[model samples]
Target: MTTPTLYGYYRSSASWRVRIALAWKGIEYDLKPIDLVKLEQKTEEYRKLVPTQKVPAFVTKDGKILSQSQAIMEYLEEAYPERPMFPKGLYQKAEVREICQIIACDIHPIQNLGVLIRVAGSDLEKRAEWARTSITLGFKGLEGRLEACSEKYCVGNSITMADFFLASIVGNAKRWEVDMSEFPIITRINNTLSTLPEFQSADPFHQPDCPEELRKN
Candidate 1:
């Protein structure tokens, strides 16, 4: 089968999630880097591909376009079941989905790039503060749950959907310079996951568009 094409920006957390998922699944894909900073997603050509003008849209090999990273991820898992992101057993899958949703549905949307850009002047700082507070709160809840269930990964000794989701969000936290000392479990998991070649290769710093200054910091 031919590899699907992924349209995304290197620095976008949403896009980053999809990238990590693809890497973890070992699925081959063509990455079409959309320059968000240059406003390429706003062009009429790209807008037609994604009417919502969002990053991380997946164009399947058969030519189906899918927006939203979470949906794309679910599709990937369902379509390619060889390496499952959600493990079997009754409660395990549910727990993984729960953790994934907490970050994907609850925290991320509020502080997404488009939302942050809309905040004005001092309000931008307030928006960022709110985002950081909410993210930390969510991480605390995740840490409690992970501490109860995690061995090496978020759910068990093996990596699951929850680990991917949490890692991606925590990576976003690092970008904002949000201190992770408060959430030791999350920090530890993030450190461990960072060592994985899949996660390391999927890191934003390794992307072509990563600003050298940001990487140096």
Candidate 2:
């Protein structure tokens, strides 16, 4: 079988979500870095692979292509079920997906690269403010939701798909300098989850394409 390939940018929260899932599943695949900063994803070549011109595109070993971080992660869960990313109970599964969508749909899009560029142009301060505002507001609701379901992880004691989204978004929140003190639940969960080998290995700072200056040894 051919090796599966993952096209993603190191700092992309969407890309980071898929990376964490792949790592947790112990999936072996090739990684192709798409430089979002330089508009690499918008190029004609990459566009053919993903018409949306987004990162975190996955090409399966059988040549099936999947886009959108949540969709790709769901596919991984079904295709490789040994290490489940979801809960077995119907309601529990829905709860996990709810947290993922809150981060992916309601929160992430407001501060992603494309939106940030369109809204703030080249103004770094504007971009940071835009991202910060979205994250701060999103975290308020997210923290409340977690207060009802969380234990050691976002949904329960076990690490599910929600933890992946939580860990990835918290990184973005810190990047924009969002105050973590206000959302103690989110901060606690993220701090606990970040230490796992899967999360650590899939971290943006450790990706091959991360800049030398930005890379963590």
Candidate 3:
């Protein structure tokens, strides 16, 4: 089968999640890079492919378009079913979703690039503060929950959907100078996740669109 295509920005956290999921599933894909910083995502061509013009629009091998990182991931889980992204128990499944949401909904939205860009014009410092504060607040709760459920990964001994979101948001936190020292559990989990080949391959720094200076060392 021909590889699927992923339209994404190198540094977008939401896009990052999809990349990691695809890599974890061992799915080969072509990347259609969109430079979010340069507003290239607003171009009419990209908008036609994705009305919202957001990065991380996935084109399946059969010529189907899929959007949204979480939705795309769920689709992958159902379509591929190997290297599953969720655990097997009733509460385990919900806990995985819950942790993913805590980062995606609470931590990611306010710190979104669009929101940060809008905030940048008025007060750059506030934008940075907002990103930092959002992560810290989200991590504060997430740290406690992980302590209860995690052994290695967020929901169990293996990776899950939550690990994808957690790892991506941690990258965001670092980019915005969010203090991560307090969230030891989160940092520890990230340390483990960061070393995995799939995560390493899907890292923002390793993306095709990534600048040479930012490429993994």
TM-score of each: 0.89, 0.98, 0.94
Clashes (N, CA, C under 3 Å) per candidate: 0, 0, 0
Which lDDT tens digits does candidate 3 get at residues 24-95?
A: 999988899889888898989888989987878999888899888898899999989999999999999999
Across 108-199, the per-residue lDDT of candidate 2 in tens digits comes to 99988788989999999999999999999999999999999999999988999999999999999989999989999999999999889999
**How accurate locally is residue 18 in candidate 3, as Cα lDDT from 0 to 100?**
93
If the candidates were sorted by their lDDT against the true structure, best first, what order would they fall in? 2, 3, 1
Q: What C-alpha lDDT do the candidate models reach, one value each?
A: 0.82, 0.94, 0.88
Clashing pairs in 3: none
Q: By the TM-score metric, which is better: model 2 or model 3?
A: 2
- Which candidate has the top score in lDDT? 2
TM-score of 3: 0.94
Error of 3 at 106 (Å): 0.9
Top candidate, metric TM-score? 2
* Stronger candidate by lDDT (2 vs 3): 2
Q: What are the per-residue Cα lDDT tens digits for candidate 1 across 44-68?
A: 9999899999898998777899999
